[model samples]
Target: MCTIELCTIVLVMSDAPRLRHQVCFALYSASKAATAVYRPVLEDLGLTYPQYLVMLVLWEQEPRSVRDLGAELGLDSGTLSPLLKRLEAMGLVERRRSAEDERRVDVVLTDAGTALSARAQAVPQRLADAAGLSPDEIGQLHATLGKLTAALNSSL
Candidate 1:
């Protein structure tokens, strides 16, 4: 806000953007709220949202290279390494050096992790119920968010 005073009149202008007017703020809040919804349910499974995400990927395949896994998750080593360590400590995953490539490390689901997938089968339906979104709406939302992510990444 700025004020300019002339002979007998004063004018004020406001240039600051409102928090509620920011699209980024809306996205941030939604992300946090969505994570909050997952927290308790995930806690029952002894996993944080990030850890759950890692397990989801590993459940889809076996013996994935750390570098490949990180790329799919959009994470760097600094962040992923510790997360993998925690999962290993939980006996849910194992990190082993690849025999084919001495420099590469691979992540594979342990017995416990493989069992977790069956327990997690109901999770998607639970989230769907919580979201109160029709299947079509969920599909549209997923597609839109994917495009938004791609656009933002390309911009970067």
Candidate 2:
């Protein structure tokens, strides 16, 4: 079969939606594809996509509380703690009691993690090149996805 024929499925019943016609499936599939594109590049930098996301926040600002990080990343302590532990073991970050609030724990990037930021500087352009999306196209997609996410989240 040709590529389009192989990729597409049509249903006679209009009421029953096809998986291929699902926005959720498209988003899920695209998210996986984006992660696959990041996998090798992230591996080269000794990072997983989740770890990279954590680093991205810390790179922008330091000493973020675990609660704040969890809120920002939409992760719970159960999930975030292990990832933080792994990054800590990697010598990329440290978790410590917040100076301002003893009850809160803050995450700080180590010197190594700070340095990794420079090495990872080219990742965005590399991914854009790999995905073959122009900057304008990327921005538009980002905006659309952001709006979709917000709308979906608000409905919940």
TM-score per prediction, in order, is 0.89, 0.89
lDDT of 2 by residue, 11-52 (tens): 335557789999999999988988998888899999999999
Question: Model 1 off-target regions past 4 Å?
Answer: 1-15
Candidate 2 — which residues are off by over 4 angstroms? 1-14
Clashes found in each candidate (C-alpha, N, C closer than 3 A): 0, 0
Top candidate (lDDT): 2
Error of 2 at 88 (Å): 0.3
lDDT computed for candidate 2: 0.91
